[model samples]
Target: MARIKALVFDVFGTLVDWRTSIARESEQALTPLGIAVDWLAFADAWRDQYQPAMEEVRAGRIPFCKLDCLHRRNLDVVLADLGLDQLNEATRQQLNLAWHRLDAWPDVSAGLHALRQHYRLAPCSNGNISLMVDLARRNDFPWDAILGAEVARDYKPKPTVYLSAADAFDLRPDEVMMVAAHSSDLAAAAEAGLRTAFIARPDEYGPGLGESAATVPVDVSAGSLIALAQALSTANTPP
Candidate 1:
């Protein structure tokens, strides 16, 4: 493995339990309006909206909207689909902020703290900047920098976003390592010449990630962030 100077994490699934957090928050927010939807299923559908929503822009079906707008667009669609039409502005705004209340995955804080001692650690999520900042503060996510789709004004898997991250740190792609739970995410980083470490978010699909943990080319594969950190701490370039 090559030395890694920076660790850019895919925030949503890798470090944070976005699905659970969004679900829980949505239930609370919806309760006031006497709207009780299947929060878990709602969360799943909401997350499902993430990819195709971005693809809309990627394919030029929609203009370049930020992730926040994209998320809201999807949220509105799902809300209507679920027959939820009653919500005050205040309640609706809070619901939209569900992403900000994301709970960190187990071992996230401890591992990131350990790794941060030896490397630069930040978020490189498809989330917007304000969303990432809010999440960091809410969960005490201790990022040296908060990067998101806002930086590139576009989403990842777009090569441009990944390279934008390299540009942000004034480093070559090879000097940066992207840690993600999703193989597709890591593939983009790796193809950009960035190193990749896959920390298995085995429950990302809510329970048992359907596929086995044996996905390929993941330079370093770990069962948890803390364990991944232990490995990275020792794998740093010798001073």
Candidate 2:
């Protein structure tokens, strides 16, 4: 157990509330155009395309591209599926950026602030660098850097994504902790030799639609980023 020098995070559900945020942003953008739909279901429908889209990239069926491009592509699919294909290109582009305007989880600001006192922090998200920047600025996230899929030219659960993040900080895999809400992500990071932390986002999908606990073993498990920071602080405290 080497001393963890940096903390890398999976941004989507772990740090921010993507589902709710997307739903809100979607309603705000689309309502102006008289598009009436169940906005929450719209958010779910759009998110449903996420994994399959990444699988296309991960499987080499598509050339590597930014998550923004993928989001735009997925947005097209969702729009067509929902009979909202009448939207013009400019409006579509605006809606596509809903991902950029997500609100962070309530505990995020205080937690990141606490953790930043002792460690380097960055997002190891599948989101492109610009997307990460937008979310960071929108939420006042104090990222020391942004390193993720676009930087690694691949998506997560892939070893390179985790290892590349470790390399970005010039730290050994064991010296970096990968914090995420998903157990599968932690399992992948563990396989890649990085320490893992699970911050449960039980409502990530909607009310009670997220995991309350990690299904896989992790170095740390907590209810929120603030709790995680406290757990790490306690662990580092000398007896």
Q: Judged by lDDT against the true structure, how good is candidate 1?
A: 0.81
lDDT of 1 by residue, 99-148 (tens): 88889977888888888877788888888888888888877777888775
Q: Which candidate should be chosen as best, given TM-score against the real structure? A: 2
RMSD of each: 1.9, 0.8
Instruction: Indicate which candidate wins on lDDT.
Output: 2
Q: How high a TM-score does candidate 2 get? A: 0.98
Give the TM-scores of the predictions, in the order they appear: 0.93, 0.98
For model 1, state the Cα shift of residue 113 in Å.
0.9
Q: Which stretches of candidate 1 lie above 4 Å from their native place? A: 210-214, 236-239
In model 2, the runs with Cα more than 4 Å from the true position are none
lDDT of each: 0.81, 0.94
lDDT of 2 by residue, 1-239 (tens): 23999999999999999999999999999898898899899999999999999999999999999999999999999999888889999999999999999999999988999999999999999999999999999888999999999989999988999999999999999999999999999999999999999998999998899989999999999998899988999999888
Q: Which ten residues in a row have the lowest lDDT in candidate 2?
A: 1-10
Q: List the residue pairs that clash in candidate 2.
A: none
